[model samples]
Target: MNKAVFPLLLLSFSSLFPAHGSGNETAALHRRYASAATEMHRVQVAMDAINAKLICRGCKIDVVDEIFSTDFRLKDQNSLGYDGKYSEAVYFDPPKDLNQTNAAPERALSYRGWYLAVKFDKNGELIDYYLTNIHK
Candidate 1:
């Protein structure tokens, strides 16, 4: 009976330790995850680049220039809306840059608390942008 119990205990202990994957298999899994992460990052960058080059829907304005221009002015870094969304306001100060573009229609209310709001992602990629008239 003691011999029989010893064999049973040995079998139970052996079953407790399951076989692990080979080193190559583990490395392969890691490589797959790394590749997937890299692909996702590349896709995000491409989408952001496309958006950065887009023209404004309201007036075909060059949004890239407006955001990147040295003369760019802003009332605030972010504006909160009724919908709980935050927007960045681009203040159109004197010597307005909008007049230099033919595509984007010039506005008479450039100084009456008018601005272009832009939102960017953590990677500094343009996500959403729009025009807003907020009385400063």
Candidate 2:
């Protein structure tokens, strides 16, 4: 084989089969997130509380009252589940499959312009969550 051709082939092979380090890193991060589920849930609840407060202000409802009235369904729910990959951000769709009898105005609010993005440290501690519009 020509020297030039050999180097080209080697380069192509390298690109086709990149290192496994990134996969391992992703798995480690996922494990971190999994083990810290309780803490993550707390962070999620706190964020939901903040969203409830924001909605209540414009709707003339008590903040505490609004919280229990709110319901969340993942806007990207299909992108999550058993095959879901770990991600730092996720969005919630409007609530559905309700009995209607217990539904409240706040429960039907749209999260159209917002997304929930979370940051975690190497230890998987909750750093913070950002509620911002999608970057188009």
Candidate 3:
């Protein structure tokens, strides 16, 4: 075969069956993970804001409003298990003790434990948000 033709044939074969360790797929996955991470950060920030507001008023009603406005659906009648409408879901821990912290003079409410979960779709859209312990 002509030298030029041989190289062209090889190129076509390689394209049909890409060799292992090729960087393309890995790069794409990396991009997806990075995008998801950025979105999770945004959700976390928003949840933090809502948490601050709830802690300030110490009103269960206000907390519920803040949660629902953020696209969260309360799972239980007690207002626990808040679920987000976006791809990500957050689970907040119940308040531990009623200890007062100097950070906020209005009211000091201690949180038992809080957690945030982020779920992403193939298109990278947020699907769910969750918050727990609002009633507890």
Highest-lDDT candidate = 1
Model 3 worst lDDT window (10 residues): 54-63
> 106, model 3: CA deviation in Å?
44
Worst 10 residues of 1 by lDDT: 55-64
Overall local distance difference test of candidate 1:
0.42
Cα displacement (Å) at residue 129, model 1: 1.2
lDDT of 1 by residue, 3-120 (tens): 9999999999955443333445434433443353443442333233234334222212233333224222222335435544334544543323436456666553345443456654
CA RMSD per model (angstroms): 19.5, 17.0, 17.4
Candidates 1 and 3 compared by lDDT, better number:
1
Angstrom error of the Cα, residue 89, model 1: value is: 2.5
State, as a TM-score between 0 and 1, how close model 2 is to the true structure: 0.24
The segments of candidate 1 whose C-alpha lies over 4 angstroms from its true place after superposition are 1-87, 94-111
Give the Cα error of residue 26 in candidate 1, in Å. Answer: 48
Q: Write the per-residue lDDT of candidate 2 for residues 18-106, one digit (tens) a residue.
A: 13233343344334434444544434443544443322212211221222222222225454335342234444433243446655654
How do the candidates rank by lDDT, highest first? Answer: 1, 2, 3
Residue 55 Cα positional deviation in candidate 2, in Å, after optimal superposition: 17
- What TM-score does each of the candidates earn? 0.27, 0.24, 0.20
**C-alpha lDDT of candidate 2 relative to the true structure:** 0.40
